[model samples]
Target chain A: MNAGQKSARRIAASNGPIPRDTVCFSCLHRLTHPSRRPASTAAALAESPPIPSHQQRHTNPPVTTAKAPRKAYQLLASPVLSRPPLLTRDLTSFEKAYYLYQKRLNERLALPFTRYFYYKKGTPGDAEWKRKIKVRKTPARDIGVYAAYGDEGWNDEVLVGDRTAERESVVEALVRDAEGKAIIDEEVVGDENKDGLAVAGDSKTGEGQRRDLTKVEVERPVGRVTEADTANDMRSLSRKMDRTLYLLVKNREGRWRFPQDRVYGRENLHQAAERILVQGFGIDMNTWIVGNHPIGHHQMNYTSGGAPAPRLAKITPNRLVSTSRDRAEYEQEEYGEKVFFMKGRMMTGQADIGKNEYGDSEFRWLVKEEVEEAVTGGYWKSVKDMLAER
Target chain B: MALLQEVTSTFLRRFKAPPASLHRKWASHCRHASTGAVAQETDELEQSSFLQGEGPAQQAIERFDPAGVAKRRNRRLPPSRYQFRSPRYYRGPLHPHQPPRPSEPSSREFAPGPFSLPRLEQTYHDTLASDYMVLAYAHLPPGQTAFKKGERLRRWEGDSPYFKNRPLRGPRGGDTLRLLRKPVTFRNVPQLQRVTVHTMSSDAINSGAALHVSGMVLQAITNVRAEAHEVKKSVAGFGVRAGMYLSLTCELKGEDMYHFLSKLVDVVMPKMKDWPGVKGSSGDFSGNIALGLKAEEVALFPEMEVNYDMCVRYYLSPTFRIWLLANS
Candidate 1:
């Protein structure tokens, strides 16, 4: 072989390959000697470190056990379905007082009312409005001058405005005039019948009808507290308006935990969780699983002293194990159970455990605090971090 | 005039008259009247007929009826001339009359929406955020320090004179530094920030029709106005010339981004023919993921389907590139 061909072969052996055009001795020298190379080329050569033995093993086939492996643990997919709070949390007394103070300050600094623009002159409605304003006796404009300087206008107490007085809603206020006249007419008729004085009652009715024009019957707002809250109904989803409620079911073993079902056949965890929801609670509810992945997992190890009582046999009867002999064999073979909890959300509908195909089971919709109290200490420790404080 | 007098007399009677002595005492203590020129002016003030209760100005206001005015003129009254118009361009901060921010109602760029919170957003807040935190948590026993990865940039090894004060070298393999995966917490939960819809049409260089169609389709799908981008460099192979508008891009944020994603995932993607789902290997190491859609797949969107004939020209079709960015 020629010198050029010999040098090219040597370069190829060291650096994988070289271009056909770069087969000259000078090119071979540049490729082989690091001192003669550019800074970038030298740096690139130094960058790659030798791969560790652990990583190198990835290229080889995986090792298989010579002996048969121990029986796998039973896998369960538990869906922790919850309902988010419907209403904002109740305001504290301090928050209420601070908001009221800010409102009063805003009113004091507001521009003077433009009465002429809103109320036309010589109109009965306008006259009635003016009369109502006269009774209020609020300053035309305070501009905080009185509050700041302690003038005669300052009362040395919380500034009381017309808003402090119980005011009817706009709808009630608008219909008040018509309703007031009817009420006065009824009262006048009653007075005339009782006293046998029609002539005197006729004059009194005219005055009363004019005076009661602004009177309105206001309906009180519905209270935030629901019947479920007062009754302490743990089964009702609507019990807590301002808290996230989780669904915890009591298994046949009388243990409180999230509704879970064993993985059947080749079904995945997500599909298993969905099946558990449908089996534990009837299909009347609308629910959605957040994702395919499990949020958390808890492993319960079975003691080697044989199967610790079969909880599944009591719940699923013949469906899971078929016969007593099969049940005993299945229980003894399984090492333990691993429960993977998937997050889910309930939009509507309540749990109908009684109508569920998975036999009779008691269920409760509980807040975070109540859930901690209802569950066992070990189960609580495993799940407490996942539950929302609110 | 008679009606006005009668209204004033009724008002006076309805308001109880204060005691004469008390009224005088209160008037004498009035702060404004106690001032310099105002005190002298009060003594000369005369009760003119025009200044009486329900004056001529008040009467004019009572007679001012917008409906009647419009009827007399035989046309609707013009909109109020005092309505504010936001400036189209914002001057520098030192300008006397500065333009309001884009978030302000008066700003020209103010686009208000998010009329209702999205279901996906609600789900993220209610469950997903906390679930992510729980799943990503790594327990460290008390007094134990976290194991950190080795420095990405190489430090000079040899004590050469030139290397004494020199900066560290760039990252080993390449100059690009990867984003660190910080432990997930309540404050640093991953969240979708915005979505960018982009389309490039080589056919646009020959005819503007391709560019226009792409822009319109992107706007319809994203609910945002598409901006045309000029080619920065000329390429002979692609038949694109520098300064030619051959691509369209639209950015969606907040409500628009969520709505677009939901529509794409729930409606369009499932209906796509022979779809293999987004490739698992499609994301940048950072939090951004990009997916490409053929012209046929873009046409499957409900918006384009509704007006199929208007935008379904196969020759003018443009492939779409969608980028989803998440802030970690």
Candidate 2:
């Protein structure tokens, strides 16, 4: 071959079709070498590091027969961390409270736990969501506060006014230092912590700092509330809600409404509970979801699949309890001066009626008894705690 | 109103919680009173089955077979017997909160989306506690170091969306590179299509949320080598995007990404605030959300495991995403 074309090829004696003496197309031998060139280009490849082709270095490690610790070796030995050795020393109530308080404070700064909780009643407004990065609130609950419960001025339960941290700590301290006999203020009504003995209340503080209770203000669950408490309890309902209803069930009080069409297809809780009051709530407790619609004032909606069928019909006013917290207001809002008639229509394809979650037939009060029975025998607030056993 | 409704709904879920008191009472009584296992041993010596027995304790165990056994495995449980005496007449968070129709929550039917939630702080975390989801909505500044999973952040009662602790697979490889054991999937993909027809009062609503997915990293470099014995570089920041391989299936009529996303703020929350995942360190959760959908909705769409690999990148991660699910 001519010198010009000769540079493109190579010959390998051991490797057949290729000659032993040849340089790569880009080699200096190809560009500027003696025409005859060296017999082999073996020196070139030997000195260079070969780049790996397509295979990835480590998509996964080689599956080794030798095992890893698997879990913490100690964890493998015991699985669970042994509880902190229970103290050998008996702790007084105050000591226990102090321990719990210190533990909680340490926990407060500990990580992440702080990011949760608080601001539970409503979703932050658009501007608020943008401006308030700390935490958020629930929309439905907030709407209720605005539309109906506005400024009853709660200082205790919610974090609306501030001094909340001090309040929390002070409460913690009280739990640490206060004696069981400390009579609670009437203001210290609800048990802040589940322990039935402890009551957390807000003392009026215009300056916004936690203040100690006036000694004999502790509230306790008396020997046992009347059959009302029992009645309320047996049904998974509570009487605390009466106060809220006392405030909302009115033409003047605000309303919490649901989308009108949503009344169907979804569950109506009030009627279901009424069914249970007449029948009885079964094992699988029924629950309800609430939301707001602009239709009107605070309105209640109930839904549940786990409800029992109603046993009675044509409930009358005489059969109803008038002094109920809920009844007095619901009657006024529902009937008004003009008087709205009891309306009824099927919930489309809903099957077996009488109070299952998807069951149809929302009540249109035909008589005063039905309305009153609904209010007095209706579901109570305490019922929300079926899980509070500990 | 929507926010309050959601919290109320969440609060309401506790209404359905298993009667801890009842469970505890029944468990303690049944467990203590049960000499049955011992009695059964005695009966075997006499005549199996033919002897037949009677006792309230034995009967109680029989009455609460599955449940009692379940509580037994994890002791110190809530009462499993009798629910609150009678809730037939209860209403509102016991009264006024009720509405004509309870909202059909997507959360009720589906499990909360799993996550690599980190509890950077120890005080807020316990190795064994389980809680229902806690959802907290916050308006963060344009920049405030995206909160890490395990970092301590202040919160209020009933404020967080973190629900419970779910053991998950951690990351593998070295500390620098990690991976979840299984492809962490999102069952709640927001369906934007149908969201519009829900007839939006749509008002001017701005919302943000914090959802906590509790799981351990499938394979993680818990202890990495810095030198020989090695000093671990304190975990700085971590983040997981919505998908390392997120796939979408919102082709159906009304459900699309946006529609579902809108609803996400109110539902699907964390059980606790800023909880850390197995790593026990909150990784900054921030990311571009990629919607995940069920395969039945469309054959053409891919799955979350393979599609959403990008979700867990190291250090710099996007913010927490709100996943709205149509059929989660």
lDDT of 2 at A229: 48
Top lDDT: which candidate number?
1
Clashing pairs in 1: none
Docking class of 1: incorrect
Write candidate 2's Cα lDDT for A2-55 as tens digits.
Answer: 333333332211222222123332342343333444333344434545424432
For model 1, the stretches where C-alpha displacement exceeds 4 angstroms are A1-245, A251-361, A365-390, B1-81, B85-104, B155-178, B313-315
lDDT of each: 0.64, 0.25
Going through the candidates in order, their DockQ values are 0.02, 0.01
**DockQ-based class of model 2:** incorrect
Model 2 chain B: weakest 10-residue lDDT segment is: B210-219
Cα error, residue A200 of model 2, in Å, equals 34
